[model samples]
Target: MTYIGRFAPSPSGPLHFGSLIAAFGSYFQAKSQQGQWLVRIEDLDPPREMPGASSLILNTLESYGLHWDGSVIYQSQRHQRYQEQIDSWLASGLAYYCQCTRKQIKQGGGFYLGTCRHKSQLTPEGCSVRLHVKQAIEQFTDQKHGVITIPHQLAQEDFIIKRRDGLFAYNLAVVLDDIDQGVTEVVRGADLIEPTGRQINLYRYLNQPEVSYIHLPLALDEHGNKLSKQNHAPAVDTHCAKETLIKVMLFLGFTLPDDFQSASIEQMIEWGCQHWSLQQLPNSLASSTL
Candidate 1:
């Protein structure tokens, strides 16, 4: 089977150094294997999305020479596909309508207590949808992290597939999109490691082959917090694309010659793919400074 990888970013803000780390990691991984590297705009949450952020993201990738394999996909345009899966699950008793509120779940010890699993007959109005979770998957092997075990409570919980506010949940959308795209592997930041088991469970629930995973270390700030849009991490300067790419490569544990500072973006990227090694990557945060 042809290796296929992707970088799916939410349209919450413009690209930052942390974002570049993930993009470059996935790009080099796919290119190294002579595989297809795809890009997808995860615009599922409208309230958090910044206007024009998607276009800005694509332009930045092009500016930095991280060109993807084909036309970019936008999750906002795939509602029908997401809805079809949800409808099928509901009809087959694999998922059900949920009326429990966030506060109620919190009061019930944070993990969902399956309070609504038997409430399939409940009205859909003002209710979220949750997977019945008959088979709880608590562990999976990561290409980089090896065997990872999830807490039993979390694994057994009947997680939501659609929010009460009429938005699709991230786990459901991501898994379904990967299946639809024929993705063979998922390569992203380690910050998302916690969701691996849940996504794997969804894959099994759908009876689709599970994709391999490789989560790159996160990019943290001086205070040790992961750099993120929520923390107002500044957008990376595309004018310094070459410099930034070199810096990112170094953070990923690459050892380049001093002359590399003058290398063009294309040259740097070609060299990166040729020398890509997962063993050199740090298992913890990449760095506190870019």
Candidate 2:
């Protein structure tokens, strides 16, 4: 099968170094195999989205020479589709609405106690659908790291797929999109490692094909915090796209000379594909962001 991969970035803020790493890593993974690479704008949360951030992300990717194949898929435009999947889940009893508030769950600790699981008159008002946990262990391999298993206790927590305020949660939308896009493999930051099992459960619940996954170490500030918009991470310079690409290459465990440092993004991509190998990347690192 032809390889298909993507970089799904939220439009809450500008693309930072952390965002760039994920884009570049997924880009190289696909380009290395001469596969199709796609871009996805994860704009499901309307309130959190910055007004013009999506356009800026596309522009930045263009500047960085991380061109995507086909028109970019926007999550905001797929609300009806998300609703359809949710409705199906509800009808099939694979998912159900829970009316518990955050404070209620917090008093009992982080996990929801499934209080609403058996409530009869299930109403949508101020409620969200939580997936019924069934797995004892959610295990999968990291293409880079060896055998991995997220414990059942962590995986058993009832998780929300839709919000009480009526927005489809990231976990649900991402699973649907990944399956719909026919993603063959996923290479993203380690921050998302926890969500892997939840997404895998959804994929199985929906009976969709399983896609491979790889979670790279996160990029962090010197303070040991992951760089993010919340941390006020600076937006990357897409103007000197090649310079950023070179930096991303070095971060991903590639070696380059001063001469190649001056190369354009297209040239860098050519070189990257030629040299791409899992063995070249760092097996472990404190932090990673392009």
Give the per-residue lDDT digits (tens) of candidate 1, residues 1-290. Answer: 89999999999999988999999999999999999999999999999999999999999999999989988999999999999999999999998999999999999889898898886579889999998887788888878768877889988888888999999999999999999999999998888877888898898888899999988887888887889999999999989888888889998889998799888889999999999989988764334454
Candidate 2: regions farther than 4 A off = 285-290
RMSD to truth, every model:
1.3, 1.6
Tens-place lDDT per residue, model 2, 1-290, is 99999999999999998889889889889989889999999999888888999999999888877789988999989999889988887887877999999999888876787788777588999899888877633687788886677866677777898999998999989988988898899989888888888888888888788888877768888787898888889999867777777778888888887699667678888888888887877787446533
Q: How much is 211 displaced in model 1, in angstroms?
A: 0.3
**78 in model 1: Cα distance from truth in Å?**
0.7
By lDDT, the best candidate is 1
- Per-residue error at 234 for model 2, in Å? 0.3
Error of 1 at 230 (Å): 0.4
The models' CA-based lDDT, in order, is 0.90, 0.85
Kindly report which residue pairs in candidate 2 clash with one another. Answer: 218-288, 219-288
